[model samples]
Target chain A: MTAPEPAYVAVDWGTSSFRLWLIGRDGDVLAERRSGEGMTTAARTGFAEVLESHLAAVSAPAGLPVLICGMAGAKQGWVEAGYLDTPAALADIPAAAVRIPGAAADIRILPGLAQRDAAAPDVMRGEETQLLGAAAQLGEGDHLVCMPGTHSKWVRLSGGKVAGFSTFMTGELFEAIARNTILSHAIAEAGPISGDNAAFRTAVTRMVANPALATSQLFSVRAGSLIAGLSPVDAKARLSGTLIGLEIAGALSLVAEGTPVALVVSGGLGTLYKDALAAAGISPAVIDADAAVRNGLAAGARALWSL
Target chain B: MTAPEPAYVAVDWGTSSFRLWLIGRDGDVLAERRSGEGMTTAARTGFAEVLESHLAAVSAPAGLPVLICGMAGAKQGWVEAGYLDTPAALADIPAAAVRIPGAAADIRILPGLAQRDAAAPDVMRGEETQLLGAAAQLGEGDHLVCMPGTHSKWVRLSGGKVAGFSTFMTGELFEAIARNTILSHAIAEAGPISGDNAAFRTAVTRMVANPALATSQLFSVRAGSLIAGLSPVDAKARLSGTLIGLEIAGALSLVAEGTPVALVVSGGLGTLYKDALAAAGISPAVIDADAAVRNGLAAGARALWSL
Candidate 1:
């Protein structure tokens, strides 16, 4: 009989949150766990302690190799894996396995991607690997993968490589503007991700028609709610729609108009994005981040063993 | 003896800075003084102390009437001049004025403009009066006035009335993204405001072409400087250009295209904006904000006396 196959663990460590999955040799997740002990908070409690505490809740072989993505490898995270500049492929990933001092397992951190385009000055991180993972699963094709989050990533994959990618601070801007700035009063505390509010959709469509008008249009959300009797929830939805739509309009410009783009959305706001994309006449292939992260980790783990 | 005309004082009291101008019967600034003392800082040192300190610096008539604008009239300012809802005209400005209990002179604080457009849902302040001031000077015509500052305002003036306006957090966003975020390394401590840099212009044009792509492009400023040898100053300029260009493109969409727009830029960045606008094929009429403020204050003072 084949010697007992070694199990593995996968982690997606983000800015304000953390997720872990214990997988069997066959890639089946045996256990899962998450926590608010993200990269920012983990810095306070030594990285090693946080990792151990989280791992203590999950079961895996003593020496099982673990794969991790997201901010876990950021400068302020458990171990800085540095960055792998863009126009990169799956093989370009830096797999400098992070050895946790006094920990129970073997761990390998994934390196984020960075790139500099002569046409414009910009770079990317974290999402490059996820795009690579998506590319690996899809095999070969030209598709647009949009990962919406605090800093949303709109990646272009061509022939199994990240040809180019762009990021939008849509989510971060939303949070900052809504909570920290003047628009806070107009937005609701909580609401459904999608609703049938014409005013909200109209505001979004207006922005799409003229993406640059976003900063000004944001005020309209509050004005509508206060002066035109728009409900706070609806106003919030309209604000969300306007921002996301502007981002989409911006991201769509990088690709050939009417290209066969498969928008692979991976984030908590996936549902909202899907609706917005639909409104824009684009049918997206929705990918639950849970599965994508696992797939990405498995691909990364496979690549490491093969190397 | 043409009793020494009791000139009115016009003040634009902002969050962290203050500008007070003693104006004569005509729209001429007799004396001007500025201070680091603003509403945000004044909160720490009581408003009365800050006001008195500024008042002491400029010795005007014994009981000159003062017309104030900006956060000085906010809820947290020295006195709260309740928000004036939209569709409000210059004549409709509230007279209640924020009552500073023990001030050296009688103060008549001008109310900020508020609006609730059906299309959008939010109100505005201070800038509305400036737009009114701009309209007051520029006369009746369709024009877009971009006032760049901590919170930049882009107002539309038509038929000598304040049609509507939109605000962009360009200055605040630039500050946050440059100093606080990952792109901090790209910015320099100081640089020439109107450097003739092609990279900066190119970045602005690219942003104009795809406004949504900024979030991702921001990282390149750092990467280009680190790997491709882009000077920090040039990188900073490019970053500024990208954000501002995106804003201009957005603002332009709100008005008729190719409709002979005049960008009346105010604040310190006016020179840089003038250069950028020139590069973008738009001729802007640069206004001396000091003069405009004096004119505005005089007009408000005259209006008060007429009332």
Candidate 2:
């Protein structure tokens, strides 16, 4: 396996995670690095030094221009890269990148997108870049994109521009509820739930049908375990299903009756959400999030420096 | 005020609270004692001893019979009183009460109600007594009773019998999400919100309108704080209104349309829930929970010993 000449560095720096990729001259990945030194950690450990250490570990050439995204551009990050309010153009995002001042090397962090509506104000940092990369594939069309995570982002993109988005605290709420509530005892002995679990699909269907019963349905987890002898795995699946189904229902409410939906996701949650969406009668166009982010960084790099 | 001759002791032993009232022969309260030594505390220190200490504090005479309700009858309580299955008469609750074995005095703990349906199983230990007390005031009707608390219970009482019920994790979820999610920062400096806050009412109305957007509405708490200049108090209010409204909507889904609704509540939450119900366009008949539980205990005691 022979390595190609590295062209630029791409980093997705989030709240508790950091991922870096050294792209080759031909846009092929030469090397990659991942760590827990995200903005939260990098803030205290020095962002520049953290970057340099990873860059050094990957053995990237000196002065390789780097493009970054995510919480690293948040207000509390190394440098505050302010938001580009909606409806923001994907093409214009590259130019809005804020450069690290006084650095010997070129380093630019992309701005997040903010929906400044009086009724539904929202913001997203890392996902805008993913949208940029995935947009080219979506072409000239209107689309509703669901990006599942701790704080899930659902974006409405039209003709290469973002109209607006809603962020649902789906994953965070799931962890908080499952760990902190009385349902914790119900879910304690449960193993990991799969996409094929009947309990998962049933919960999703129930929530989509009557989302008003959200909290009551949650209490049923405790009740079901206590009286009906519901096993723990099924209990956890029901919880995961209820939350994910509600997210899909909420995102679907924002779009039209027949809008095309896409799921931009990676890892295990990809399957979980896919099952949930299917349970909600949706078949989204799937996009690999890893490829999306790398391509987004690549697009930003090409615009800033034609390497 | 001259104290009357005590006949029996009525105790509401909840998860974290203990309230004992000494009832006179004329069905008047001779003395009352309140403490935090509920089931959680008493389980460690001993339930009989805790009762004795409280009884001694009130200077109750020896050989007085005690009627206990709530968690003290749970499986983990001092003695497992078991449950009286739904559709059972509320008047029959006292006869089902389990007397503690080998006790000097006649100590009987009331049974809770259990809805054992596969679709919506639920149980309540303490609130059943509240229902028994509140039931007489709501005589001869098919009614939807809303008892709001940590685990809010909504009961369908048809002709003085609990037909079915649902439990909503409203208060617990409110505390968990506020303290554990990203919205925690949004609500960090928030002062306690009131029932009359416009933001609270607005949120309740919005949730009742579109219950599907429950999690998204929660995110707005953070978004509003970040971009829309929402004050911390308003943020907290919005967070609260959303949960309470969802509970109301979920509870409403279970019963028939236009069923007469009643709110049996105690403490500060009484005002807050009344405001929420009003926001949801509900003018429920209000019943004081404190009075309801006492009356329920008195009814049970009268049935058991003919005092």
List chain B TM-scores, each candidate. 0.87, 0.98
Per-residue lDDT tens digits of candidate 2, residues A239-287? Answer: 9989988888888888997899999999999999888888888888999
- Which lDDT tens digits does candidate 2 get at residues B1-307? 8767899999999999999999999999888999999999999999989999989998999989999999999988999999999887899999999999988999999999999887778899989999999998999889999999999999999999999988999999999999888889989978889989998998898888888889988998988888789998999999999999988888888788899999999889999999999988889999999999999999999999999
| lDDT (Cα atoms) of all candidates against the true structure | 0.69, 0.92
Chain B of candidate 2 achieves a TM-score of 0.98
The sequence of per-residue lDDT tens digits that candidate 1 reaches over residues A210-290 is 777676676566556555776777767877888788878877888887655555565557667777777777877766656
Reference contacts preserved by each model: 0.57, 0.90
Show model 2 residue runs off by greater than 4 Å. Answer: A1-3, B1-3
Against the true structure, what is every candidate's RMSD? 5.1, 1.7
Q: How many residue pairs clash in each candidate at the backbone level? A: 17, 0
The TM-score, computed over Cα atoms with residue i paired to residue i, of candidate 1 is 0.78
